[model samples]
Target: MKKRFVSMLCIIAFLFVSICGRIAYIVFSNDFTVSESYNSYVLNLETLYPVIYYYNLEKLTDNRDKYAAVLRPNERTLTDLHNLFPSSQINEITNELKAGYPLVKYVDESKIGNEKYIKTFRMSDYECVQSQLISKASSGLLSYVEPCGKREMRFHIDALGRMLRGDEGEEFEESLSNIKGIRLTLDKKVEEIAYSALSDMQNGCVVIMDVKTSSILTCISKPDKSYLNKAFSQYNVGSVFKIIVAACALENDIEFYYNCSGKTTVGDTEFSCQKNHNHGFENLSDALSNSCNCYFVNLAQKLGSKKLLATADKLGFNDDIKLYDEWSFKTANLPNKEELSSKGELSLFGFGQGKLTVSPLQMCYSLCTIGNMGVKNQVRLVYSSLDENANEDIVKYKASTRVLSEETSKELLNMLRNVVENGTGKSAEDSYHKSSGKTATAQTGRYILGTEILNTWFAGVYPSENPEYAIVVMKENGKSGNEDCAPIYREIVEKLNYL
Candidate 1:
């Protein structure tokens, strides 16, 4: 009987220890009990997209990979997460949140829940913002997304949809999860200007970047009716591609003069200029400024496909630029080098015709390299991101590489400057900011009811004397670059001067 009693005592002891240990784990182990109590907004500077995903952490492993996938830890620290969500005044947006959007507060309790401010919320409340994040976390499709620009901004949301935070540290009040996200490098002034230009258009995209920092200043694609914003869309490059041809020629030392009688025959295929009028004798610089197609056709044949591909590669053509570790850009597609053996094919490739398709961002970055004295700075959208932990992070981008020699880039810039000052891009010249850019009209064999459509482009760098920004303005089914795009470029410069 004593032995049985001892065995019962042992069993009770084991039960007590197991219960205590489990309780201890629940109380002390950080992983067992979720430590993260909050989340902030996330944004992309390069793509102009906002990431508004909020996940319920059921242990870190369950949602970490998925959370990190959308809201990348670009360059933010959890400690400063409060900055991502400021204490701003309660406005119409706050009213909507009170009526039902997820309302979250990061500041001291004293700073929130006052009149004209958002009501404080619980992270676990289903009717609160936390619940919305949980719902989205389980959802296969990201549903909480919103545009940060060109909309009526509620607090941090932007001028009701047509603006964003202008100066940092502007005193605003908000007690909600929606009012949080990183400020993109996009200058509201620039974006407003570009948007104003394309406001009436059905399809077009404009991009302007700081040459030195490679930070996007303005990125707007018109008629943003679809989630597929056309700013990231691809197009046939057209003649503005002559810049690449010219650069390749300069790189390969295949310089020569050509006399254009409006057109040239390549294996029985006639390549004609837009004017179709003889340009007489022309030097390389003059040909580029005049946008003489006959010159580029001959130049491409002389340089051959090999040299053209090399220069295009150096300029990041047919490649993807990984942006802030959030997402990679789509590749700028090009045709196979060997396929250009035909003189007719090489002639088309010479002036950016044929199968050369690229995105506005890629073209902008390539021009940025030329303006940056031939060095290519890694293109980025956001300076940093606020991770789930609220940590602020700045990406450590790769070192700049020399794509064009200093001399070659200088000559190219000079030619481009002359283009604005005297060539087809003369209309883009501005009194506030002298600009030099190239204009091209890319033809899409796709005709609309018998009328052929073209992609009009004006790509150039600003303050010809001191390069600061590289801009590309493109319009689909538009006229030549000078007619449809140059005027818009001038307007962008005028706005930049005011900003």
Candidate 2:
């Protein structure tokens, strides 16, 4: 009896401790959720971009593929002689047409004498709207080879699922009602152009978009059909993100002038410029053009975390972009004020380090707003979904929010132009057209023998005065943005000039 009483007492004490720990956790955590592990943010292996599609429609020609085959595979062969005669008492009728017993019979009207069935074959004979579905039932928008099947009546979808021809066949209403094509914002010509350039790349993505509209013209993820779109996948963006920090600085009217001794320390955390050498004294535009780390870090510390976060929020960071429940191009993470309590952390955040991660798409969009004279259009992937009839049921999705002011836009545009003219991103310049851009070589922390792995990046806008396009290129583990990514950007710019 004494032992039993002791056991009961211990159980009661254990329950009390558990309840107290839960309360303490809730109180101190302040209901802020620590984000999920890094791997959880990735899309699934088999997940295809459901919104990937093209806008234009071409009419499919009435030409049918001609072929020749002796008979359908299901029909009994001539070797099955027992079932040859339909009226034979010794055997039963086979499911398929008996081979030996020809169905040909004398008829009053004969074009090629007596014939049982047509001799030549055409794909149209075996193909119907239902059979056309046999090929594309598995893949959504990923396949470039397997074409969408024909509706038989008149309309036939092309290989890429773009509606080539539309005219309701005899069953136009029924066929149209059955067909649903998800329209994507991808331009066929632009996609082709981007592909031809990046085709040989082992891995990476090439993204181009309409700066004014924020509509992606081409988004081709490399490794051809990778489940994760590296173009939109978030990574430490390095100094390419300086544009955002710079914008924030300008918006807050922070002093753009500072002296750089090449290295500075914040609470024992030393930060150095790229070359570990002094840049002397410089203004904001010079710092941006030179890609000075010390200048930005000092600016970030002075601005404080609250103001920086506000700037990031205004520019769209640490936000949810609900593209799908399990799949999406999510916004990148930003440091909270509490985490920025230390000068080191704030400085790191200022220079695009310390847990900062962002998709190329997000960066492109931010630059688009700068190019769009501070107007930010919602990133649109799809124009609308349509049924076969071509009837009007357009799902219009478009909205614009001013992301920056016109004055800031003008100043920033000029600063970007300076970058191409006399900055780390000089390769982005062109002889004929004005260009503006930023280059970055982000440290990945995973080093070997004291050498660092990197994520190189380049973000640019062409025809700077009145920008038409936003272009971005990235290379994983590529050492320098200028050496690796900038040349690729130049090639793309030259190609665009041809157009």
Candidate 3:
């Protein structure tokens, strides 16, 4: 009997310990309960969009200054930034959230009675904005917070008691380039600006047109001091001038198979490759691809300055081509007869490193000329005249004139295409699109007494079988054209691929 009693006592002890452990668990679980409450509040907060529901204490019907906080609105404004929301007025938007306001049918606020406030919202505009934001956010293009130069197009206003437009007065003034219809309003927001010709660059513009129909696509420039259509005013063409050297060589009957012994001594001066290492023996195609100064200088000695100057002038280097707006670009200080007589300087001109100055737009024109198989077009920045009705009237059908033999143009193009595929410009390969181009690293700034820094470049045309577009990219003080400019060109081409 005593043994049976002891066994029962042991069972009773186990039961007591289990109950105490259950109590301890309940006591330690305060964090879990608080977390659940916080998550539930967050879920409720996300549903508010077009309409914000908050406190409305007026309906308490109690004879007290503050009637016990019972008549609270379901929502309140989270931020006072009116520049982020362009569509809503504070009072009108939040009115439905007031106590005793009629609830919309699409949204369910039935959980809270008429006396209590429940936030709910639905709007087509809000849906559209949300969809666009979500789509762009995943692509790493949109940000929840504004980055520098990227301002929110919408906002919320607290001081005005309504949603107000963000003040864009300073930006509109500063952003004024070759842009049209940009006017500052009394309210400080930009009233309107034609989007076609707007440019962020300090001075930049583009004039694109369809040749057959003479349909103008875009004419844009900014900083009103400059015009889009003129090519007489000088800008650094940088290494883009290499296209001229390539043309001069072929025009002078330089064979693509001819070889350069890498280094050539002219008088007492020695001109060598940027690598300083010898290319040993390379053909004309490789010389052009590798941008060999010795090979081009040797060839330029044969072509002489007269032929090179004539070729550049014929290709529209000397003349000013006007784009839309008042902008103009022109070639700078061409080598004279005396300078061209020196073998070293003449060779430098062939490689586009010394004394040969042109504009970025001009270089683009030369590339287009080559792509058009020696037909140089009268470069048009604006293809039509804008009427009073804002309709574009066709004014010009710029036809291309023969600049070089078609065979010569094709030969040079094949050599450039091969460069992109196998030589110095191999990095410029567009996996998303097929392109043909060449890289150039022209010395622009003096690094030491004799040596100079390079301005890298990559110029090309796309869809090689039947070309449609040509582009040039230049990076100042870059180490190599293949390294710096080619990647930028690749990105620009990829962006243009879908368009």
Model 1 alpha-carbon drift over 4 Å, by segment: 1-183, 387-391
Compose the digit string of candidate 2's lDDT tens values, residues 1-499: 9999999999999999999987676445423232222111111111111222366642112123433222221223223332222345213333343432222111122122222332222232222111111113322132332223432222222222222221111211122123245455666677667777775666677788898888877776667644556776788888988898888888878876889999988888899999896898998899989899999899888888888888778776765553312234466877678889878889988888887888887888888888998897777665665455654344454478886888888898898888888999887777665768999999888887888888898888877789888888888878788887777777777777776
| Weakest 10 consecutive residues of candidate 3 by summed lDDT | 182-191
Candidate 1 is scored at a TM of 0.66
lDDT of each: 0.67, 0.65, 0.50
Off by over 4 Å in 3: 1-240, 256-261, 324-327, 397-399, 447-452
Question: What is the TM-score ranking, best to worst?
Answer: 2, 1, 3
- Top TM-score prediction, candidate number: 2
Ten-residue segment with the worst summed lDDT in candidate 1? 65-74
Off by over 4 Å in 2: 1-53, 58-179, 322-329, 448-450
Better of 1 and 3 by TM-score: 1
Global Cα lDDT for candidate 1: 0.67
